[model samples]
Structures are given as C-alpha cells and as structure tokens.
Target: MKRRATALATLLLTGAGLGMLTVPAEAAPAAPTRTTAVCPTGWGSTQKTGTSAATASLVNIRTGRHDCFDRMVFHVPGVGSSKIGYRVGYVSRLYQDGSGNHIPVAGGAVLEVRVAAPGYDPDTGKATYAGKVNKPLPGVNLTGYRTFKDTRFAGSFEGDTQIGIGVRARLPFRVLQLPDRLVVDVAHTWGTAR
Candidate 1:
C-alpha cells in the first residue's frame, strides 16, 4: 500500500511539471501610436481669378484654419436695398510641386449656390425686363445665403488654408463642370468682391 501511494505522488508531481511547461508567458502590450494631421489657425485669405469673359469672372477664395477640418462653409450676408442676384460655385484643386510634379489630392464634390428674394420680382409675368429695362429692381432684393460640406480632403493639406474655388455670380448664369475644372457665367448684374 505504501509503495502504491509513493508511485501516485510521483505521477502527480510529473503531471504538474508538464502542465507548467505548456503554459505561455504573458507579453506586454505594445506602446500606443499617435496618428493624426495637425492644421493651422488664421492662415489669412488667399484669392485667385480665372480669365474674364462677357458674363462674370471666376474666382477662388480660401481661408486658413488653425486645425485641419473636414468641411468648409461660406457666409453671404444680405445686401440691404440692393436688387441683384447672388450665387456661388465651389471646386477643389490638387497641389503641385514647383518642380512640376503633381501630388494626387482628393477633389471635393461640386457645389452650386443660388439666391432669390421671396414675394418680390421686377417682372412678375415675364423673364424679359421690358418695363424696368434700365432699372435695378422695384423693391429691396432680399439676398440669401447657403453652406455646403465636403470630406475626403485628409492628408492632402499643406497648411491650415483649404484648397477650393469660389464663384459669385450675378443673374441668369450657369456653372459648367468639367473633368478637372469648373466655369461660371453671369449676366444682367454685378457681384461684389470679398
């Protein structure tokens, strides 16, 4: 009986040792990684213009942000006692190096904005300005404003300033979208420069 008991204890010890050998040591977790793009604030204003035509000029306006943002908004305050039309066209251009190498940047979706006053029209029945052909308008033109948002501009920014095009047009205008550019034209009005 004692021999049997000793043999059982030896077996138990050997089994315990084998179990210990099969266990794996815990590994320390890897250090956390930092991943983000930092943009700047107050980059001032940058403006560009396209070739002039009979209707209106195409302009590009960009504002600098201290930090990178996913979207951009344009604010057009109402022009009191002014009878004119207001519109905006937006586009994004990729960055280019001085050496002629182009960096592949994501382009923002096209956005077009139009403004008109409610309950006011110089010509109520017709599109032609026959009665007031030489006048601005009969009443105060209640101007309107709007904002559009765009994403996918990440990692393509050189600084806090965003890359985009702004076109403020008069009336009876059209925006032509191309594969890599946009064109806007206006008639019978004037657009204020910002």
Candidate 2:
C-alpha cells in the first residue's frame, strides 16, 4: 500500500508537468494603421480629397449627400475641444463618368462649403486609443455608424479607424442656422455609428 501511494503521487506530478507544457502562449494583437476618408461639410455629394485625416465618416440617412446638409453650417456635435479645422471649395462642380473627366452634377448642384476632417475608412473596424501616452478620443457627439442608412458601413470615431460618422442622406437643401459653421451632429449617423 505504501508503494502504491508513492507511485500514484509521482504519476500525478508528472501529469501536471505535462499539462503545463501543453499550454499555449498568448498571441499579441496587430499594430494600428492610419487611414482617411472624404466629406462635403454641408455640401451635396461633393467629396473633396486631401482633407484632415479622420478615422470615420458620417452621412445623413434621408439624403445620400454624405451628410444631413446642403451647405456648410452643421456643427461637429462633440468636437468642441478637438481643435477642428476646415477648408473651403466646390467639390460638386467637378464630376466624372467612366471616362474620368470633370463633368457636371446631375441636378446642377454645387456643394459650396468648408470641409473639415476628411472621411474615414471602414475596413479596419476600430482602434485602441487608450494606452500609454495616446489617450482615447474626446467626448464628441458624432455618432459612430448609426446615423446613416448604409448597413454595411461602420460609423463614428471609433478609435483610429477610417469609419464614417455623419448623416448619409443626399438632399438638395442646406442648414440655415450657421451657414458658415460646421456643427458636428451627434445624431448624424443615427445609432449606426456606435
């Protein structure tokens, strides 16, 4: 009986050692990448390039103009402390067909406004903005992907991704309240941006 007990204890210890050896090591996550998108800022389907780098984009649902406006007056809902910037131009006038030439907008529309913070890419999904010296994004009211009608589009400023976060409606009207102000619409993309 004594011999059997000693053998059993040795076997148990060996089994425990083998189990630990079989454990797999944790894998490290991939590094984040930078990206951007386009916005008309109260314009009508006018996408301007070379704007500020944004990780996401928002468009009005009712209209396909990539925003809930026809001119630049919409404010960035929660970007009060974000130090937002802008640039004025007419992107709607420059159109293109399959030939890649500057054509005209179908309804003779011209997006006259200042674009601030270019749009975002939706491929990467999200980013980790809370670590080390890089803190998370501020409390901007801009919804993630909920405001737009595109189900395939991921919305809002989620981390450092290129997802759009604004109203995606294509309307022929413009915001009159602040024609020169770009109000960040917290409810721009509805609940989709979150």
Candidate 3:
C-alpha cells in the first residue's frame, strides 16, 4: 500500500509539471497601434496668382463640413482655366460688401475672403450672383458647424469680391484654385494644422 501511494504522488507531480509546459492555443495580438489621419500642410495665410483681366463671374457660394476642417467654396462660371487670385486672412472687423460699413459677424475671429473675380456681369452691368449683397446672404446656412459661425457678403468692387467668414477662432486655412472655383478650408483646431 505504501508503494502504491508513492506511485500516485509521483504521477500527480508529473502531470502538474506537464500542464505548466503546455502552450496556449492562441495568444492575444498586441494592441493595435493607434492611428490618426495626417492633416494637410502649408494652409496658413496664402495667396495665388490670378489675372486682373479675367472675367470670371461669381455664381455661387457654399459651405461644407469635414472630419478635420470646414470648407467654403466660391463658384465662378464661364472662366476657362484661368486662376482666380485671392487673399484670405483674419481681419479686425467685417465690413459691408460694397458699402464698407461695419458689419457684425458672430464668431471669435473673422476671415476676409477676397476673390479677383467680380460678382457682376460686365456686359449687362447686372449682378451675377443673386444673393444678398449685404449681411446674411440668402443660401449660406451655418446651423451646426464647429468652426463657422456666420457669413456675410462684403461686396464686389473694382474687379474684386469680398466675403466675410466668422469662425470659432483664427485657425490655419488653405486656398485651392480649381478651373471654376476657389476653395477655402479652415482647420477646426490650431494643433491639427496641416
């Protein structure tokens, strides 16, 4: 009986040792590295080349929301591949489009967008864009945006048209020139500047 008891104890110890040496069926993968989108670079105050004789007429103005930034597009029609010159920067105050009167916009900072193209048809001497030339242009709506607060038409004069954009703060912005449009995108945060 003592021999039998000793044999059983030896068997139990060997089983326990084997169990510790067994490999797991699978090991959990190392936690995936967190990834983030790479923001665009060089989007601060910028200017592009355009022509003074270009006859691009402003047709529309609109805004869109993005994951990283807010966008504003100024559409000009009937101008081929001509580049529209523009200046985008923060301003102390927003002035009326044509009258140069102080216009109040709701935001922490105001961006002045000036396009080289006019908002009128030179042939007919009539306004090409039918929106309000004053504060609160008819179609631009900024209801649930994070950066944009308000938009106002600053007016068109001497072959240049201006629009006032109210943002949460003075953030990094980029300008893009398409065949028929000019695009402005403002970063939601200064840290996320591309």
Give the best candidate by TM-score.
3
How do the residues 13-108 of candidate 3 rate in per-residue lDDT, one tens digit apiece?
A: 999999888877686467787676667655665443445435678988889998778999988886656777787788889776557688787799
Model 3 bad stretches (over 4 Å)? 1-35, 46-53
Among the numbered candidates, top lDDT falls to 3
Per-candidate alpha-carbon RMSD to the true structure: 19.3, 19.4, 4.5
Report how far residue 167 has shifted in candidate 2, in Å. Answer: 20
Clashing pairs in 3: 40-194, 41-194, 97-154, 97-155
* Ranking of candidates on TM-score, top first: 3, 2, 1
Better of 1 and 2 by lDDT: 2
Ranking by lDDT: 3, 2, 1
TM-score of each: 0.19, 0.24, 0.75
Q: lDDT by residue for model 2 over 73-151, one digit each (tens)?
A: 3333334443334422334343222233443222222332333432332464332221111221233233343333221
Model 3 has an lDDT value of 0.80
Say which prediction, candidate 1 or candidate 3, comes out ahead on lDDT. 3
lDDT of each: 0.29, 0.33, 0.80
Candidate 1 Cα outliers beyond 4 Å, as residue runs: 2-7, 22-56, 59-68, 71-194
The residue-by-residue lDDT of candidate 1 on 1-194, one tens digit each, is 99999999999999999987774556545679776544333322222223312121112222222222222222122322232233343334333222333233222233233222211223342222111222222221213212112222211111111222222321233433332223333221222221
